[model samples]
Target: MPAEQQHCSEKSAVTNSSTHLPVRAEWLATHSEMALDPALPVIDSHHHLYDRPGSRYLFDDLLCDIRDGHNVRATVIVQARSMLRADVPAHLQPLGETEFANGVAAMSASGIYGDARVCAGIVGFADLTLGDAIRPVLERHISLAGGPIDTGGRFRGVRQSLTWDADASLTNPLYPTTQSMMDEPLFRRGFAHLAPLGLSFEAWVFFHQLSRVAGLARAFPQTQIVLNHCGGVLGIAAYANRQAEVFTHWKLGLQELADCPNVMVKLSGLGMRLGGFAFSDRERAPSSDELADAWRPWIDTCIDTFGPDRCMYGSNFPVDKGSYGYGIGLNALKRLTAEYSRDDRANIFWRSAQTFYRLPESSMVMSSSNR
Candidate 1:
C-alpha cells in the first residue's frame, strides 16, 4: 500500500490517531468526490476577504482558509473597503481598495502560502462616470497597489456597483446604486473606457434592474460584463409572495442579457440580502443544501441561457457568512452542481473563472490532488 494509505490503516488501529482518523478520512474523501477534474485549477470567481470581527480574513487568513479547506491557490481580492485615506473624489471616496490589493501582495511576498501567490487580480473601484478623470483615478489606484510588489499584471478590472432599492431608505453608502447611474451617459463612457484598458466590468444590481443590465450589455458589446448575485433578487417581505412571477421576469431578462456575448453571470451572493432563508427572528443560518435549493432555479436558468462557459461560482465570503460560511456555501454550490460531469463541474467552480480573470495555470491548485 502507499505510505499515506498504509498510515491511514495504521491510524485506524491506534487509539489516538484512530480517534482523529475518521474525521480526517471523511474530509479527504469529501474533497476528492467534490472534484470532477483532478487537473483543473480552482479559482473562487467571486469572494471577499475582509477584517471583520469573529472571522479570519486578512491575507494570511485567506491563505490559511484556502490551504486548510481546499485547493485554492490564487484569489481575486474584490474591494471590501480597506483602510485607505478618505480624501479622494466623492464618488471614489472609499479609497481603501488600493491598500487591500497591496495587502494581498504583501502576503504573497511573505511566501508562507506555498506556491499560492495572492495572484489577486484586483477588481478595484473607479467612478467611470468621471469620464476624463476616470483614467487618472485608476492610474492613481494602480500606483498605490504597485509600490511594494510586482503585481504580476493582476489589476484585472473595476466594479462600479449599481444596486438601487426603490425604497428611499435603502440608501447605504456601503452599497450605492441609483437609477441615475444606470441611465447616465457619463457612466456609460466610464464603462466604455474599460474595453480600451483590457479590463472587465463587474455589475451589482437588484432584480428589477436586470433589464437595464441587458440594455447595458447590448450597448457595450466589447466589455466583459459580469452580473453579480444572480441579479440581486430579493425574496423577503414585499417581494416574498412574488417569487414565481419575479423569477420568471428575471429569467427572461437574464436570457436577453446572455444574448450579449460579452456578459457573464456570477453565481454568488444570492442568499445574502435575498431573505428567504434568513427571515427567522433569531437569524438562523441556512444549511448548504438550503442555500443551493433557494439558488437552484436562478442558477440553472442562468446556466441554461448563458451556457456554462459564461457562468462561474463565487463564495461572496464574509457577507455570505451572515447566512452561510465560506466552506458551507462552497460545499452547497458544489452539491448543487454534483450531477455535472467533472469537466463541467470544473468549469462552473474554477475553469471559467480562470479564463475570465486571465489567471495563469501556475496560480491554481486542484482540490482532487490536494486530498
Candidate 2:
C-alpha cells in the first residue's frame, strides 16, 4: 500500500504495515478554514466508502465530513471495488457492492443522518472486458439500486478505472485492465450496454489516454462519459520533475476530448499523491488559497476547455483525504470558482452532477444563506 492511499479494506491490513495509514486527523487540524460559502449546495460527484485495518471512511466518516461546513447535500459514490462477494460467481460478485451502497443510501434517505444523502447515486463496478456477457450483471446491479430514494434512479453508472500506464508503479491492480482496454472489442461490446439502459460511464484514465476517451465518446455519441480526476493527471514516479512536458501534453489531450460533446470532466482529485504537488509534505496543512493556486493551472484549463456545464466537482474523498482535509479541498474549489456567475457556480458545485446522474433536485437542501 502507498502512504497516500491510507483508506483500507480488511484485506489490506494483513499485508501492509501501519505506516501506509492515511495522514492523521490531528495533522489536518493544523490548518482549518470555515466554509467560504457554507450555504451553497454540493454534490460530491465522485467518492468511495471502505474500511481498512488502520483506516476507514464508511458512512459515519463521510457524514462527518459533510457536516464539516460545506453544504454537501448529496454524494455520488464511485466504485472502489470494495465489499465484493467472495463466494459468488465472478460475473455476479459486484452485486454485493451495489447492495451494500444502496443499503447505506437507504439509511441516508431516511433523513436520520441529517439533510445529506450519501451514496445517492451508486456507480458500482462491472468488468466491461466481459463484453456483451456483462448485461445480466449490469441489470442485477441496477435492480439493487432500487429503493425509496428518488425516481431518477440510484444506480447511475460503471467505473472500471482503466488507468493503465507503461510505468508499472502506476497500475492500481484493482482495475486489472490491459493497456488500451477502451480500444478492446470486448470492452466496447460491454460498454454498448450502458446508454440503452440509460446509465452513464465514468472514465478514469491517465492524461496520456484522453485520446482514447475521445474515441469512445465518438463511438457512443449518446452515452454520457465523465472523465475522472482531471483526466487522471499524474506527476509522481517516472513522471517526476517534468511538469512542463506533462502540462503541454495533458492540455492538448484535454482539447481533443473537449470536442467530444458527450464527454464531461471532474475538476477534483488533484490532491492525490499521484498529482505530485506534495501538499502533504509541508509542516502545516495547506490553506485553501494554496490549494487553489496549486490546482488552478489544471482546473482552469479543464473549466475553460469543457465549460462549467460539462464539468462538476468531485471531492474524491478518503482517496484524497491523505493529501488534505475534506473542508479545505472544497473550500479551495469555492475560491477557484468565485468569479463565475451564480448559475455557473451552481452547475460546477452540484447541478451538473445532479442532472448527469439523474438525481432529483429534491435531494439538495439549500441553505437559507443562498449562493
Give one digit per residue, the lDDT tens place, for model 2 in 21-57: 2555556767777789887889999988876666566
lDDT of 1 by residue, 264-336 (tens): 8888876464545441222344456666787678778878888878888876654554444345566677777
Please report the candidate that would top TM-score against the real structure. Answer: 2
- Cα lDDT of model 1 overall? 0.64
> Could you tell me the TM-score of candidate 1?
0.80
Which pairs in model 1 have colliding backbones?
Answer: none
Model 2 lowest lDDT segment of ten = 10-19
**Best lDDT goes to which candidate?**
2
Error of 2 at 211 (Å): 0.4
